[model samples]
Target: MSITRRTFALGLTALGLSACTNQVLRTAPRGAKPVAELPADLRPTPNPGYTDWVQGFKSRAAAQGITETTLTAAFRNAGYLPGVVDRDRNQVEFKRSLEDYLAIAASDERISKGRAAFARHRTTLNRLESTYGVEAEIICAIWGLESLYGERRGNVPVISATSTLAYDGRRGALFEKQLLAALQILQSGDITADRLTGSWAGAMGHTQFIPTSYQAFAVDYTGDGRRDIWSEDPTDALASTAAYLQKNGWTRGVTWGAEAGPGAPAGRIIQPQEGGPEFSVTRNFNVIKRYNNSDAYAIGVGHLSDRITGGGPLRGSFPPDAYGLTKDDRITLQQRLAAQGFDPGGADGVIGSKTRAAISDYQARNGLPVTGEPSRDLLRRLG
Candidate 1:
């Protein structure tokens, strides 16, 4: 996902990179944003179990070399965050087809923002590419997908979110490890606890690195002696991402892959969705999977990177869906719905809740069955 996949290898909501969210620009196509402010549910709440768990964890953290002073400061305001638990417990309910994934992952907003961000940060990105031997657009694509050009780096307190998830007893051991790594970051003085914010599941900064991943790979590209991915400047985060791909074995100058065609690169052919366009992926493609192990994610990053470099969208088209509707049909239905005074929310062809509501409202008024699903018959009727 790119839905709340904060570090899915920890098997959290999403981030090797795990899940995604609705906003996608915040991102996973899977795009999950940490809003302008934390919601009430995300704030701290009393939980005796969590308090007790923290005591034990503190002792264990000490055994693992965390200082008593660090623990004291780290936990001064840290506590259980129920919203973190809610987010951890809930995940993307359904699988998204490649087409739907692209619709969100490579949406117009993301593409446009990606190009502008590339130009805005061209110097830093180009410098990182030279240092790490990764493509600038690749780095920019990850930035777009991870935090939407630094606009949606989360605001949740890492200590509270990780500690709460750790004590929630679901992925306790794993998050406890993240909590421990976060403490180490704090101890290293890269950032203060007050400023250590990220997604609820612990993915931090512009690139959404989980604490452990941050520990293993983060870099201080600005040479300011700190990897400050959490700030408005994205130098360190982008370099760290480039470093990750290079260290993980990105073949220099090799194309990730592309929709198979006369111009396609030589590599293994994979079709992620049935009757969809075929892709030929290279070793570098697998390198991207190291960030978030989904074929869809890898494609989203790759395609979005190409688009940012001024390439076109995929020329191939996916077949009709189970609803016996092609994307064009859906667009037509939405246009027709809006024309009839029903709002289908501007015809992106996804047929979300608004489209369903419009369809149902129209159905009820016409004395038809209340099922809001689209069909060829529905399209004809809308006409």
Candidate 2:
């Protein structure tokens, strides 16, 4: 995840925002000084409340076994970042249709990059797959989505961003814990305070593991004695992601999901948006959800992984989004269906599995082709 946008993928809020916190310079090596401060104009206006909070937290951190030296390094120049709070407050909810999401998640260019990355990391990925029972392509897919194959791991100062969120008090405890975990990471000598930058939300490294998750799942894959997820070499980060999946019950040899066709295996069918491709997903699909907790996100990972491994695109036709039908139109359609004794679960504008099932049932009852698509024509028929 990019720090400001995708950083929340490490299970922070359901919004995938405000997930982790730490501090290190982007270009500095371990133990090096944090680089040049921001331009005077860009510096956040000093907030005495934030300063007080940091001071109190410093005491608490010391109580929690964080050494003074580590705290000093982590807190140097740390302050509230208004941009972090802005991104958190303005997160778009369910804004992307499945088609839109898939187009970006598994774009041809991304697929090409993924294939090259897969081939490049074949030896290490193969070893990880053999050892951890997680597929290399899946790992690569996450790498692709989280940071564009390490091209954009975020440059936010984890300490400042995380501290600002904690001070913001919307999800104070969570951010505090992340802040403490970051301190532990620093104390462990894994990465220096000068080099610990990540997404604005603090999701660090190649696959964007939050601080706590990094502590639990990060591995020293190259025998470097440090679980360095932020470094240029992606081996440790990739291994850590595989380890995280395996630890969270990613089954060996089990497909996450497959495109639904005739005689597809028995599993939960999830079509994130009406008229989009449907997938019959397995238990492993749920496992993927442990990372980002979104059906669209999990499916994107699975499909992108498939493409990376030479699989084809989804074999379903989907209507383009952005016709005249708005959320109110969808609610009206649902209300009409329910009034006709063909309940569409609820009148929420969002199309979900239950809503799609109801649409299919309504279509079948009317002797129409069972496409499970919500359309103006269908709404007109119901009216």
Candidate 3:
């Protein structure tokens, strides 16, 4: 969700860690080769089984009313990009501390831009909120995160990437469906082949709507026949995201959450694991999880939403037992815990049940509060 290194490792592990077991696990290895510096065109190609899938995709597109010209042009020079697969597979290593993630994601630049955009489009956002029951700042934040307010919607062709992934056979069924959806969009003339570029996963536009999301939620806020999320106008994209959250049960009049102070009374702490960081999340927080099913992601959005609405940071520090941890600190704790045989079950860094259990075990052995938290004292003992 937030794309932390620890989360990537856990994702890889979820994909069956055996495939990646031979690779090194360190976040930063000494003398490692830089992947970005690798020569282009030296990567591997599809296994030849993908052509049939591509043909099927084209046929499905045609059935959906995509013009032959659009389909042909979109797929003409499209080929499997090994780099996309590599990125999709290799996973990230550096975990963004919560503060760091928020600082960048909701930075002055983003906030300044967001506020300007919000002010400029006050009428539109207001209408959208009234109609969709989703807040303006949340929409602005999504816009900021997805494409930096539409400055970088990616250059990779959506059809090509989806086709490649569909043909690759790893997640064929899923990608094939997405490929068809992309073609449907093309067929509808909502966007052209050249303008239909997006992330490797086929998520497009200012708010990174995958084909299905685009088809399901995209709007013609500009009164144009087509839903143009790729345009400089963010009205359609923001509206679409709002529609999505509203559809998914976003509650009106409720804030995501507030920064808890050190003296704040403990709310209903939902510990993912026995010794993980305690969170007092609300029902709306669960709604954010539906958007991206990760605790950190939900928390990030919640925290960012609060900041955009002029709220302060968390007042109380996280329970630290080992790793001198904060919210972000849990990611590294998870990784190190895994290395130490704790197996926190996919190091996405939100201290779930297994992580707490591991922390408790570590604390019991080391003579500390078996609170299973990663407090400063625990970090000192761990050190």
Candidate 4:
């Protein structure tokens, strides 16, 4: 009943959805046109095998009650996305330390934007909370983590993505089921073929529900007779998320948890990153995990929810990283690299791919070995 991720890249990625192992990370934005609007690699490419696979799947789909008209319309525009295959094959579950994760997850920009989003949608969020017995901030936090408040809701067509993965055969069985469910969504007419876009893994909308999970938990708070999670309004998306948590045993009116400290309530004590802050989690926290079953993601959602509610950053300090560098040192390194136009992305203190690339570039430019690894000497050199 949930969609999850393997991507910190798609960032829809990471904590991938229910049975789909693909991450929900970054991808094309909403309303990208086929061929014309999409990047060349993402456009449908010629694949005889994929064509044959679709021929077989169409028979199965027809057996499953998908009308011939719906099949034609859905596949008329949908084609095998080579990029989705590339993303599926190349996804690596890199472990970002909680400190680094928080730097990106609850950064000033995300928190500020989250608070703004909270204000803008307070009425609807509160109404959903009342209706579903889930906290508004928790719902907002999931919204922030899932698609950056809908700004990055992916535009890859669901039919193509699911069908491609289904044909890829690595995870064919799961994708086949998802493919069926996606067809059902089309058949039901919640969204048209052209508009039924989602992440490369077929995770859709503000909260990134894959087709099966969408069928299981999506709600139409608008009551307009359609559960439209893809719309810019986000009412249905937020409501669907709230409904998910409520159904999954979210304890009404309880905090997901707090840093284990004074007045911290009794619950599970988990320190996902050793030497990082310890959290005393409540049932609500586990309910959050039912959305994305990762301690780090659950913490990201919880902590980001806290920050969105005007809470301060975590009071605990993490031990130095394996590189023997503190987060501050890493941040300083990234800032200096970015200042010189090496561009390590945001100075989030996460030595991610971009940061490593910047490090390698700086090293090469300065006649140093291009190890791309950071060291105190490198930090000092950056100085």
Which candidate tops lDDT?
4
* Tens digit per residue, CA lDDT, model 1, 90-205: 75534667887787678888899999999999998888888999999999999888878887777778899989988998878788888998999999999988888887778888
TM-score-superior candidate, 1 or 2: 1
Task: Give each model a TM-score.
Answer: 0.89, 0.75, 0.67, 0.94
Best by TM-score: 4
Error of 4 at 26 (Å): 1.9
Q: What residue runs in model 1 are displaced by over 4 Å at the alpha carbon?
A: 1-22, 25-37, 336-346, 357-368
Segments in model 2 whose C-alpha atoms lie over 4 Å from true places: 1-44, 262-265, 324-383
Order the candidates by TM-score, highest first — what do you get?
4, 1, 2, 3
Better candidate number, 1 or 4, judged by TM-score: 4
**lDDT of model number 4:** 0.82
Shift of residue 269 alpha carbon in model 4, Å:
1.0
Off by over 4 Å in 3: 1-49, 60-67, 92-104, 107-109, 260-279, 319-383
Tens-digit lDDT track for model 3 on 307-368?
66676655544444345555556566667776777666555555545667888988787676
RMSD of 2: 11.5
Going through the candidates in the order shown, the clash numbers are 33, 7, 18, 19
